[model samples]
Target: MRAQSGHDPFDLQFEADDDFGPSSDADWRPAGPAPSERREPVEDYSPAPRRRAEAFDDLDAPRPAGSVGDNPVHDMIASAEAAFGDHALPRITIHAFIERPRTGDMIEHAARDRRMERTSVTVRDGGLSAALLAYQNQPTPPLLVVECCAAAPELLAQLDQLAEVCDPGSKVVVLGAANDIALYRELMRRGVSEYLVPPLKPLQFVRSVSNLYADPSAPFLGRQIAFCGAKGGVGVSAIAHNIAYAISEGLGANAVLVDLDLPFGTAGLDFNQDPLQGVADALGEPDRLDPVLMDRMMARCGEKLSLFAAPASLDDDYNIPPEAFEEVTQKVRAAAPFVILDLPHVWTAWKRRILLSSDDLVIVATPDLASLRNTKNLVDLVRRARPNDTPPRLVLNQVGVPGRPEIAAKDFGEALGLIPALVVPFEPKLFGQAANNGQMLAELAPKAKTTEALAQLAQQISRREAPVAQKSSLLAGLLRRK
Candidate 1:
């Protein structure tokens, strides 16, 4: 029967046995016990010892705010100013695990700060436990923030678990409900970077983060002051060059004037220089720029002032990218104590970026209807873009042009919600002579009101004063022995 069906004889035997039932129960025993669940070893939960030694050693020390002459306090204030100035935060990743909604909102708002524009920020819920769980197998970021709602002992224990997962060199800031000094000291001893009690403001949080990364030993970066016009002929370039000269000559500080108006810049012409290579060259090859190359590219306008003149040529297209401009400006600022950027009236991405990033901005506008509207728009953009910074300084240029209908300086300032820093009247002969001679207002007429005003503006922006000239005394000359 099996041969006719073309089936195996073993299959036929098995079918016959199934019909008769199993003779023994040994063939159907259950499988072995399921494999035990895998888990990380408990021994790996110990706090990292390497970072404990690197914690702030002066956590318990009393920080005294001394008088004006105190060097320590002055140093501290200067450091804070540098951190809050035009210098942007370094590139780093931040992960914030916030449990309280209030703190979470503040952290989110702080992430939107201009200084944090280049930083990577991530906010998540569940606080320390979530951080502990998430970073068990993965690496922690450069900065880690967590909110703990527990008491001192429990918080310290949880922090131990958190420290185990944190990679070496990672900074940890804890947000807690307690304001106890003992708790703060203990946490610092255990390698906590900072411990803050809640009710935090966004700016305060930004300051804290900035202080952590500020390097006191780092080289100084110059402050940039950008000048732009509301219209094409508002004298922005001339003002910028004069300010640069004043800062260098009057205030006795090294300053560099960079002409960003590639096609129609007047910095070279105003300073009476014809450079071989200038700002255009630096922008063309930003990657190759360094202090040495920058030195070679600049023309020495004065003993303390350097000029990065523009090509002022229309023969070639100036299609440099926005990032290149930023990179070149950064390099230029590094070489001096103060930098003046002469921006053209044309609007572009690079121009906007430079204006917003400048430590100080000056807008030169004529007292005309068109200038009023354009100035209003520019002020609004600056306010919206730089919420943390002060408003742009306004310079009322050519205030009294005879027979030309003009808005009063007071009225213009009222409309813009800003007072005019300097109101320069229409002095055609003085300006014309200075331009023709390639001399600043101060050089042509030292005692002129306009020259004094320009000098005062320079002093105000640079936060410095010119050395008082000693009056020539006949008695002093007689007193000197031969």
Candidate 2:
């Protein structure tokens, strides 16, 4: 199998419908619509009043026979539904002139995040001077981001020129490579919306734009859950897939499952969909990840479920930086109510950051010496790093495999000082069948012991029920019977 990297597997390309289109003359500049010269008299209306019972004016009164305000209750309900479900943010347009292609690429990817779907972005090569000349005679856009690599004094002088041509209501975000506090202070004093240093992460760029228009009273952002295995071949992928299924199918929330194991992810296989133009594509160019593009890239599994499948390829080495992954994950969180990350078992800096920063973490292991040692290490590290967060939930999978002399569930739990949230047995036939058929364990055998265990784990992580109400002895009971 060919290894796939961040290239768009399905070759999906997006082209914005430019309202300005093109110009016939090289010297032509945009001058908004010409002023109208004609005016018409405004029509006024006065409806004749009808004599009615005093009760007609009451708040509870039925509508008068033929008025436009008929069916007040239905109108009220419709209005409420519209307001309650409104997810569209205000339309913003970004024009960025960054000197570096890599920086420009990151900015473009952040521009296409779902939050900016209604926002139009055009990134070009140049700096503040280019931005100034482009808008010399034209109206400035809602948002303008420009970069300058000149020395501090020269940059300040160029920005003064930019400020002269900037219209009254436009917001400006400045980018530079200087580390001078005086320059940052000066930009703020000149009404610059924000000033960012070079080597910007995609998330940093996106957040700067988002904060400019954020409402203090808006609803809470989505929750993120990260899942990783104690060791490879320990069934972490299967567990992550099943839990994601529960969150979407059982809980009825819009869920996005992000398979981060780019080279060896199994979300597509487990969910039975083609892994084309998914997480890899989004991570490859975060600037193009708005709702419309993501909708096309994601595999719709069910009404409320979408899968950000990984491109399991060997042809390309997917060596993404930690910062890029962070930005992609945040944008994914912004796109859905719940996000589940299927992390691979690799002890790198990025992986450690992912595990430590998640809202919830699940570490899957089996009852063996290697799993136990690794689980203990991960648990201690997570606890020490995130003192305020609850400990990582332990899941013991493939327990009670015949003749494999495993540690007792009680002993394993005692050793780690954390009880097992889910203990699945070595039911090879059932798990294998489900994998081969591309179905979740719950779908294959609803009443099976393993399915029940998975459901419990889902409920715990989703906080649908109290953790104390859960039974951790499911596996121990099965083992005792044997």
Candidate 3:
């Protein structure tokens, strides 16, 4: 596991495409002659209108009519979802040299974005000249942003000089006051990542940086939803497993459920699986766990669902460090579209890290005094730790247990300032039968209310809608009856 501490951000390697760097053509310096000998007029370029059929010609050849890529609207929606999804920016440093205070302020605000939490950003007021001076003796960062107000020729000359000090593989983005397409193209030819005109929004700057590192060929990172109990015996594991199964089986999405409770996890028994290698093995050697190795360690529970079962043994000590868990989970997310983490009812540094970093968190608690206190504590910690994110969802489970004095769900929620997402009554028969039969609630009773609630929870966390059932017409119903 690589620790975020004790490392230089500039030394971090960015996974950029080979063509991302400047071209090797000798004429790549600039168009025409040297800046001192000749000057070219900058012309305003505007795109010509195209016929409806020709509009999409520049895009990839059309896919099958029913495929997602065939519809431009669907493609845009998918791109947005992937961009704002549960992925974080890679650990790298960005240095911005801006001559205007507004640009520097925008970049500073963009640096505080949640996706940029892992990145380090420094904003200076010196523009391109300052960058040239700074990087002359030191190494350039992975990404650099410089603002220049010069025209095409002067800007090109300055960039040509700046290129001498820039290290290989370092990407540069230019911010200027001009909107000339010719300048944009010339910058592209010179290996600049992007050129933006002024009046930039903070989110726009963040998205530009995000797009630079976006790989069209890389696997999509999955959304991770972690489930943990407010106290022991709150049935957190069962809820997590059911939701994961619902996401895969009901919503038709691929999902992976990881049991992080290495010593006493019940995922194997719940799914009736016995894999020799599981999460413990991956955590022990995170650097060696690639996609091929991950497939070998996972237990296939269904057509669309997989399980990373824990060893669940007491033969050896399981004093694994927190970094190992982080590294293993990061690898697992790339293998599926949705990941469910069934966290044990214990507090540690690793548990806190997972809770804070998860895309969505579900805290399950029974209706009681002790549960109330602990749930409030957890909620407060999450609220403070993740101010930019949505608050952790609260689930009041086993609300109406017989012969036990329990607090009302409304009162419990009022105390914590969070409304319960779902209030499930005490139903021992259904849960027990499902457990005894080694099946999920949906498998045992598909029409049950609790099963439906779990399915809804799955949809909520995954940000995906289940297929809607169409209503039959009256004529069709009559024909069928006849």
Candidate 4:
């Protein structure tokens, strides 16, 4: 694919052969199926006339072969492509420096195809030095993507000098031949937005730059709170729904409730919304999900609350990648200030990532050995992984079930070294009525203790309250012994 204009941004090639990585001969190839492996022919590749123009729509379109499942890179690229559509190019400016001819061509193709409407993309030859010299007197664009054909030390040195000229708010991405983890870590520590090695997958390159411009510290971006159950029948879905409702109604925050238990999700029933279209629809075609599409998919539960009700179907098994979850939640999060993920009681890599990455976490568990064991493990994993964030809030639900021989709340807390933030008594009558009526607990019984507890939890999360303990207690030793 070629650039759209005569002065194509990615047309130039660098003259340096200094060394892109430790291994000088490491070849570059475009991402996805190798060239020799593509079986389909590019038959009649003209895109249908639309207001927006794309230089390489055919490349971004779904491969006739199938989906690019589970590739985080692919998902990120897809999201970037949508954001940088021809309509959004005018306000953004991108500067790309390429060392390899093929890499330049591939990047130029992607930039023209996915660039925001009216956005200017300037590609020049002469890797790092060219950029340094170019920006020595001129102002750097909002984004700068430069290539380096040097080893780690040289690359780092060049970047240090480049940093001197970069504007305070400008973001930088590095494209090099280096694949060393240590170098990657050091680059990250020194504040590099992203590093990519390439024959240049156009999508991946574009996505990396797009991510650099996504201000992670912005307050308007939604905060994801992953809610999971310690054991089955622990009412995690119910708790998640209530929390979302409290956030929306009581706290006056726009909230999105996503039910992820594809097979047995109760979000639809809990909210009294039919499952015509929702999370399944969004996940089915994640690449198509934008704010408008997401708004159409959500079922508005109240003034500020929307629900992405799961299909909860049993006819066919749902085999979606964890990346799908990341994709859907990411889009949905952008639509509201608070995103409550009703995660299913299943432990998987995707689930683990969601748990670890959430801005806040709530573990709904009952007082039992199984709940105790699972909750302990989950807390341990979270505490170790997210040492800086507050520990996951533990909610002891259904604490007083008659003749159930339950564990004591204090013992449960001591065992996990995490005191339950809220203890909800087993009130079957209240829950059953709310479930049957398709109303949130707070709506059905606003003055009830459970509703008050739910509200408190919401405040804690929204306000970023400190945890009682910074580290888990020694109860982990007892749990292991048991």
Candidate 5:
């Protein structure tokens, strides 16, 4: 296989010295990394703890997992890879005192990766405490790699103190000798970004922490297809929901269904049971969104299937500002392995934004003049607007009305110079019965022709095309023109 013109690949040389912590090692002549000091040594630094029992009881809780939207992990990796690529580089600031061998090797390992530019500063008396203070006062870098080796009790006490002053925004990877799960759980709960058992593997250390910014997921290796329709009676939501379910059940781990319609939207209703809360509540507070929150939000439909739904709430408006989506969607990406967004027809700013930003967009439509006119306008507008997005995936729904004349699927496809991805039949009984029963078509009528067609559509979307198209849809055109 040949490399893409602008792409390059490289390997890392890692060192497993995490006990003491990370450093640059420029000044001192190097010997093999220092052996982790004996943990059994007696503790000299001891003071009656200031913050008492209730503090430990109420302590560091994990960020709740977010609603598993689609393939959020892949989404995050692709985003990080694109946002902070190899050449763009991320600077890691390492502050450790004395010749901390374990921490020094970890920093050395970080330096080996293409993405990191690691720098170290050694302060004598400051030790872990001083390092924490200096880091607090200075502007935080993207990644902060620190090493502290105090007895279990003293190290934890100092970390508690360090947590008070450390920059919350900077990712902090802690290195310590005690391999206690209680301490590990406590550190993670307390917001120590990631905990490492000492004597960290060189490759594992560099790769693990560096992975925070790497795009390493299956979907990122392929395209993500999302479906939405023009208006309520347009059959768009039904099409979007069905296609996603089919993709999940039929296509395995290759597809996911997301119901972004918060208020009156139908994914939850379509599946039939109210989740305690959904994407609306999750996005309401992006800073706190994580794996734990996502797990709670997801309602599993199958082994490989999950749904990110709108709260079936009518009391509040679904309308929100545009920038809210950037993070909200990012959180969703971390949950699902395959993301299919079931966008509602309403053309608000963020709705248009999500449509335009999708890797693949499918506009589900009826074969009528209004649908054709709107679809064509949407095609033209999305192509022009994105200028960097894949062409919208064209889908013609309910092609032949029983008695009414409608445009031919080929003609509809030809007028737009794009083929209809799928042309679903007008089966009110089939669609209605399934919806009323809160069942997916695959389960309702596994052998149904509609189910087979949707399943095929999912297959095509997963095709791993290189240099993916970047285009906007008529959805965005509609937003701008309005």
Candidate 6:
């Protein structure tokens, strides 16, 4: 979350591997006679190809071809699938410093999708002091990857500075200019997790780092889910709030609900409390944010639920840039076990980034012609926007309204090309009473039909309950119990 809060309205999306072994999980069959190698305490790296294809080509030697499904990589992926399940973002941050731009770009592509919360690039520049200063203000992002050609003498001071600025827990990876065995040994001793010779492929860079922190136990691999609407009145905020509340309290997990509905956010209203500063206070000064700063931003609602609520005012235009979002969410990812973003029913560079990069997505909708169409388009667009992410969950809401022309549940699902995970039936009486009382459905009317339904939805989202055939009506269950 290095603070560069400017929206590069310049870059567009649609932009943009691996076999490995015990040697850092990306065991590449190193070519013929080994080239000269060197190692050191402060720094280590031999020359590596700057472009992606060349870097990976070194490891592309022929092996028995097998489908990704059968590969160990894919098996790990499948077992870890629940962590990548529907409706939330996985928490992982990758910060890389590269001396060469092409090589840096290649590395960026290889790691962009592996469910990383953020991949930040800090260009290698001037000298050791400069690099240290550039990264000083920022918290040592969880996984630090540095590609440099600096000499051992020069790297010593740089590592010292990095050690000072980096948190004790941060993982550091170095890519040096030459295969210096001594330098490699030295860096590993100095606390760098891994060091590699340059002219390496994107897969090499990706594989080594991924191996260092591969499971949920690793620091930043939690989940981050963002809730958004395809159109206004699509019930995005309400659903997001309810889900976050359930995640924190019902599921016994630590959860943070961020209300990005800035001007008109309903989080405070939904949770029934007003906090001092909301998203504005966090984004207003992106540089000053840290775990302590985040403590100042949150308003605790219950045992495990906290909120970064939006300031409900138009005192000044939010005009928040994309970078502001990057910083806030980055900090949120580091601190919370789960972060839920209640995005407004609008599109912008910042919002798009939030949606596209979030670990999981939930689109709430009413089952009508307009909701169906907008949800369908949103699904398609979001799928494209995040080619690497799983599809967004569709929540069909307010179904079976009396005397209203409504889309049949099955027909609605068919039209959208996605089955609705939870069909929340119409219950104006209970919903209104709960809202008026400033209470969650479980609290306001725990026995009510829709409230019961909300609880089931929460269970499904938190993975406490897996998906199954269509559910019976909560009202019917209530009657049966009676």
Local distance difference test values of all predictions, in order = 0.75, 0.70, 0.76, 0.70, 0.58, 0.64
Best by TM-score: 1
* Sliding window of 10 residues with minimal summed lDDT for model 2: 39-48
**TM-scores vs. true structure, each candidate:** 0.76, 0.53, 0.68, 0.54, 0.52, 0.57
Give a tens-digit lDDT track for model 5, residues 453-476: 776666556532223355889899
- How many pairs of residues in model 5 come into backbone collision? 40
For model 2, the stretches where C-alpha displacement exceeds 4 angstroms are: 1-220, 465-482
Model 4 is weakest, by summed lDDT over 10 consecutive residues, at 59-68
Which of 4 and 5 is ahead in TM-score?
4
Q: Of 3 and 4, which scores higher on lDDT?
A: 3
**Candidate 5 local Cα displacement, residue 326, angstroms:** 1.8
Tens-digit lDDT track for model 4 on 1-482?
Answer: 11123332212332122223322333643333233311232211112322111333222222211122333433443344334321223367878886655556665555553223246778788888899899888988877878886766678777767867777667688886645544555566666777776434545455555555555464345778899899999988888999899888888888999998888899999999995788988887888998898888889999999999988888767777788887788777778878899999888888997887686788999999999999999988875564323457788899889989899988888787666767888999999999999999888999998898788778766653223445766998789889
Per-residue lDDT tens digits for candidate 1, residues 1-482, read: 01112332212122211121112434422112221122111211111322211111121122221112223432343344455565567999999997765566667666776778899999899998898899888988999999887655567767766755667778889887655554555566567788776445455577888878887786678989999899999988878888898899888899999998999998888888999999999999999998899999999999999999999999989988999999999888888989999998899999999988887789999999999999999988986665445467788888788899999887888898776878888998998898898888778898998888888888767767688898978888788853
Greater-TM-score candidate between 1 and 3: 1
Q: Over the full model, what C-alpha lDDT does candidate 3 score relative to the true structure? A: 0.76
Which stretches in model 6 have alpha-carbon errors above 4 Å?
Answer: 1-209, 212-221, 465-482
TM-score (C-alpha) between model 6 and the true structure: 0.57
Model 3 clash tally?
Answer: 0
RMSD of each: 19.8, 22.5, 12.5, 18.8, 20.5, 14.3
Position 462, candidate 1: lDDT: 77
Residue-wise lDDT of candidate 2 within 325-351, one digit each (tens)? 877887787778788999987888878
Q: Model 4, stretches more than 4 Å misplaced?
A: 1-220, 464-482
> How many angstroms is residue 303 displaced in model 5 relative to the true structure, after the best TM-score fit?
1.4
